[model samples]
Target: MSKIKLLLAEDEPALGQIVKESLETRDFDVTLCADGQEALQTYTDHQPAIVVLDVMMPKMDGFTVAKEIRKVDDTIPIIFLTAKSQTSDVVEGFSIGGNDYVKKPFSIEELIARINNLLNRSLEQKNADTLKIGEYIFEFPKQVLRFRESEQNLTHREAHLLFHLYKNKNQVLDRSLILKKLWGDDDFFSGRSMDVFITKLRKKLKEDPAISIVNVRGYGYKLIC
Candidate 1:
């Protein structure tokens, strides 16, 4: 099998080389960029399996890079490397679509472990096939929802959220739980994003009047058909 490609964005030259060499030793194909703008360009060109972004970088910060990446590919896993250990910083990372946050001076072994674990989880999610949701057939891998001859292609976030709701169809899912599961935190920003996704799902499913994602007031939501 081909080695997994990883995009590493770090402005520090010595650290960038060290990481690139280390990951190459472990059978990974690494594309190292020295600044955020270069990182973004490399990402667009390479489309690596995973992204490792340093929070402090020239041109743009990791947060900004993550936001831009999310606009194009929401499912690609992003790991933030930063010296900032503040709770707010961590929350902000997740809110911008980061899959994991690793502090600076982190052990390469631990970083590798986190990368492997996330890759495995992502792979498993991609392996899921079609699922029945009301009268619609959710094609998880394709990010498509189909009903009869009509179909709607969904964004990665939308498809992921809908998958969870369909999994618990007819059952109320706690709002906070869903937020934590998808966004890694239940903060206000993540909550608001979840609400947006819920609205999008409702709009997508509106073609089938019998299908409804009901808001459970102060609790959560339920997919009722």
Candidate 2:
């Protein structure tokens, strides 16, 4: 059996060493970094299966590091460690692609549990076959969207976004939710990218007169079918 690899970034030397040693003992291959810049570099070099980041660090913040990582890989699980536990802070972490969070002073046991839980959850989510939305048929596995007499091929992101829209058909799917779920970040560029995909989907589904994906102002979009 192979050990799971994780990149851990913490500015505090004592805490960083403790975490690295602890996880190593539990059969994890841990790469420790003292700052966000180093963390990002190590991440690219190591290609770890999971990432553990501390929110505050020298050079760059963990949130920034996570954003950089998200640009290349959206599905990798990210766990954040921070002393700040305000509601807004937690939301920001998740909005920026964090899979889980551990507050300062957290026990190693708790951290281990969160890490295992995310790893398990990652293995459990598998997309289903197809969906019937309005007058169109979506073959999810094949990334095909079909309307009468016409069919459109979809990219992986396109197919995934369409699945989310279909799941929330007739209801508003928050733009932040879309960005976070697909792009793994709700930053400006991610939002703009999502807008492009929305435009693409609109064009693809336009033939179905009964189906429309409308932008719900500042909140998000609604897929009405």
Candidate 3:
């Protein structure tokens, strides 16, 4: 199998070295950069398979770097590595097409698992055919979401979660099942993260009165049609 290429952009030298070494030991080809500018430059030059970018940096912020990267390539996976845990920051990261986010002081094992999960999910999405949920039509290959006369462009996670729910439409999906399947974890934190995405999805599908993403207390969620 071909080795995965990873771009790790961190401001702290010690942390950067540690992450780089850990990834290399896992058989990944990692390119480490110290700031956002260099990270963007390296990304453009190397076109790594994935990127792990720090939010706060010297030259530029991680969100800015992510925007620059998205301008050049729309599909390469991006995982934000930041110390900020505020909901707004996380939402901003997702707005910029972030595939995942790893907070600072995080375990290397969790980081590796997230990287693998994101990559695997990206691959799976690339191979999906199509999915239909309630009144919405999800065309994975075309990357288009259609609902009646209104059509919305979705980010990667939106598409993935919608399709997965469609595949199991009308059934209640446990919180843990949805989390691990979509985000590689179902812990308290990931559970909260999933809630934000769920709210976003609900807003997008609000036009369809027949469709509902109901939260089942202590159980999971039901994508009712």
TM per candidate comes to 0.74, 0.63, 0.70
RMSD of each: 3.5, 6.4, 4.8
lDDT digits (tens) for residues 1-225 of candidate 3: 878999999999999999999999999999999988999989988889889999999989999999998776666788899889977687678767787888878999999999998888768766666666667777764557888787888776676677777666788877787775556566687788888888988998887789999988898888887
For each candidate, the alpha-carbon lDDT, in order, equals 0.88, 0.85, 0.82
Better of 1 and 3 by lDDT: 1
Q: For candidate 1, lDDT tens digit of each residue in 10-92?
A: 98899989989999999999999989999999999999999999999999998999999988776788999989998788888
Name the top TM-score candidate. 1
lDDT of 2: 0.85
Find the 10 residues in a row with the least total lDDT in model 1: 121-130
Candidate 3 Cα errors over 4 Å, as ranges: 71-75, 132-137, 146-152, 155-161, 174-225
Q: Which residue pairs collide, candidate 3?
A: none
